[model samples]
Target: MGIISEFKEFAVKGNVVDLAVGVIIGGAFGTIVKSLVSDIIMPPIGYLAGGIDFSDLFYDPTGGDYASLDAAREAGAPAIAYGLFINNLISFLIVAWAVFLLVKGMNSLTKKAESEAPADAPVEPPKEILLLEEIRDVLKAKA
Candidate 1:
């Protein structure tokens, strides 16, 4: 097959399509989690921690008079970006908790669905027995 045909076949595969959709949704979810951490969760946390901004929680080794972490970094001063780390940690916890709840709910729903479905429906007779009965009837008629 031609290169275009091979590419088309690969792109049209169900697994590849599903993977692409998953990647898109995951990216969107990450953005939402990041926003929740940076905007909604962090402000209250910062206020509780004596007005300490998590993103600006850093210590400069040189004790330079830079205004912000970016300024310090731009001045080539050594500083620990602990605030960013804390923010990321919070985001991880939130995402993990969300995933746990989602999986748990899905599992419960699956179990409930299975339990509600009828399980003891009567089985039909085998086709072979029906065919044998027909054959016996035909033979008796001939006799």
Candidate 2:
């Protein structure tokens, strides 16, 4: 086959399509998780931590005092943004937990499906067996 045909065949494959769908969904999921972390979860956390804004929290390696992260960046100063790291860490934990729950549920379903045996149905005997039984009946009648 020509390369173009081969490429077309590969592109239209089920696995490739599934992978593309997964990537798209994963990107959307990442966006949702980011929003959940930044908007929903972080607000409460920051509030509980005495009204600290975690995103603006940073450490300057040069020991330069900065009012905010943006200010530090504006001055072209290097900083270790630990608060952002913390937020990301929390986000990662949340995603991991979600995936774990999903996998656990799927595994539980799989196990249940595998453990449940199919109902036993009566199977017909072979034709030879039936013929033998018929012959036996005929012999008994003759006797």
Candidate 3:
């Protein structure tokens, strides 16, 4: 009823702990996805695009000649960083795809588990009636 008790109840709940774990794993997964995009995938694409560095892909709006995106940013110039955008778009797609596959696999697993359970298992009988019926049949046979 008190604030401390409510806080204790919330902290002890399994859902909150599971959520914390998920957040930690998601952060780690994000780092791996970022590395996979920037290190492995983008380099070859940049090479095909005439050795363009995706991070350095930008244009200065101030009409000043800047060597790279970093330089333009350092010079306080406004620029459209389309290359970084592309990289981020790809990362988003990859992460989405990964999550989709994970969810699909989990769904399939759950369905499999459900299907494997016995369909004929007792759903209703209270058990006392069955025992009483057996006792009645035994007494009738004795008579």
Q: Which candidate number has the best TM-score? A: 3
Clashes of 1: 0
Expressed as tens digits, the lDDT of each residue in 64-115 for candidate 1 is: 8888899889989898899999999988998889889999999999999999
- The CA lDDT of each predicted structure is 0.91, 0.91, 0.90
Each prediction's total of clashing residue pairs, residues at least 3 apart in sequence or on different chains, is: 0, 0, 0
Candidate 1's displacement at residue 5, Å, is 6.4
After aligning candidate 3 to the native by TM-score, how far in Å is the CA of 110 from where it should be?
Answer: 0.5
Model 1, runs deviating above 4 Å = 2-10, 62-65, 122-143
Q: Please list the residue runs of candidate 2 whose C-alpha ends up more than 4 Å from where it truly belongs after superposition.
A: 117-143
Per-residue CA lDDT of model 2 for 1-143, tens digit only, reads 69999999999999999999988987888789989999999999899999998888899999998899999999989988999999899889988898899899999999999779565857889999999999999999999
TM per candidate: 0.73, 0.76, 0.83
In order, what is each prediction's RMSD in angstroms?
Answer: 4.1, 6.2, 4.2
